[model samples]
Target: MTEKNPSQKTVSSRQNIRKWLLIISFLLIPVTIFYISPIVAMMGAGKGIVTSAILLYILLFVVSLVVARLWCGWLCPMGAWQEICSPIFKHTVADGWRNWIKYGVTVLLFAMLAFTFISAGGIHAVDPFFGTVNGISITSFQILMIVVIIFLIIFAAAFFTGRRGFCHVLCPIAGLMVAGRKIRNLIGWPALQLDTAAGHCIDCKKCSNECPMGLDVNGMVRQGDMENADCILCASCADACPKGAITYGWKKK
Candidate 1:
């Protein structure tokens, strides 16, 4: 057999690196969730106003303003879990009104936070490690069971709805990121995005097939509309496209 070209090998290597990075992030979730869970933050917020989880969400939103949901692709443990389930259920999500579910969940969550803070008189105290047992998430059997149940729900969403279905339908954090990304787009700020050259496309559907979010990447490329709100800027399409038609780039306006 002939040797693989260097550029193709490079793309493959990058894709593998991305996968490993996501896996590493997934492995770290047992620790990370102690500092990132909205549920925990909300519980703390009910007693006080500021917590590590709230701060983490804020940081993620700020990063999303520049990177457009990169957290969902590169760092989210939930995304990693859903992807790990892809082998058993490689389902495609249909484009429809179901996409509004996340928005509703986000709005409700924000409303709850507002009510809780208002009832508490707002910012009375701060505890970065609130709701966590000495900064550890799995401190008890009950907590471990809760975490397991949460992961099961996320996996079930992916299995039933499609790849990354929880991100598409139920993740309040995704809604927050989408809002930040939209703000960046509206402000014409330089941000991470996909750049496509339709002329180089060979009509192969690899991009769509490889998309973890189940987006219509091939149609987007053919129509020269590569800026998708749902896109996580993962660049899997860029790595999969044999024609080198798609690329990740920083775009202003």
Candidate 2:
């Protein structure tokens, strides 16, 4: 009977809390749908109105320009849903075709949205409740069906591809944030990102194993190149590292 290594066994309180937070966010989708709905964004664009979801997308882009993809790790209900389904398969998603999917989606969706907005005359009004049912989502059977199918797609993505598959493969929001992060990197601005002290690493590999995004945190540390656009700055690696080799902060990277 061999004991499990602490590095292999430990799931830190920080990560547990983050998982719970994301789960809670998922549960709150009914109340939050209008604020994050991609469909609403398109509808709003066509109406020449700025919807909550449209504003949210803009905010997400701006925030990512400052802090990378914190929204993906912190408050995205879709991300939370993926986290819930990831454990069912418990594997890394294929990094080939799937990884490029979001980029294409982002470009196509944004182009269509921009076209609609421009054709519709652009920014005529602002409506936080653009497509909501008296300020709440899921107000009808038809709406419920659409919502269910969206969630089902999210579920299928994670179950089949494993570990935040929708995020890597199909999230337009993720594509937006990735673009923002790239811009930030190019600008060399002070922003929120992971910092590493390679000298402090002892090659435990716990950081790599603990990442919910399936990132190579250990490799990033060893290479001293921690500025990955995919990194959500969730700090799971920071919490998992016993030697405090990895941390997150606001600085030029």
After superposition, which runs of candidate 1 have C-alpha atoms over 4 Å from their true positions?
1-6
Q: Estimate TM-scores for all models.
A: 0.94, 0.90
- Model 2 has a clash total of 0
- What's the lDDT for candidate 1? 0.83
Model 2: per-residue Cα lDDT over 1-253, one tens digit each: 3333255334466677788889899998887887898888898989898889888888899888988889889889998887777657588776577788889999998898889999999789999988887888767888888888999998888777777778878888888998899998888989988888999888899898878788778999999999876777788888778777887678885
Relative to the true structure, how large is the alpha-carbon lDDT of every model? 0.83, 0.83
For model 1, name the residue pairs that clash: none
- Tell me, what's the RMSD of every candidate? 2.1, 3.3
What is the lDDT for 124 in model 1? 81
- lDDT tens digits by residue: candidate 1, 1-253: 3322236668778778878988997888767776878788788778866888778788988998899888888778888888878887677777887777998898888888888888888878778877766677777889889999999999888788888889888898788899998899889888888988898887778899999898999999999988877888888888888878887878886
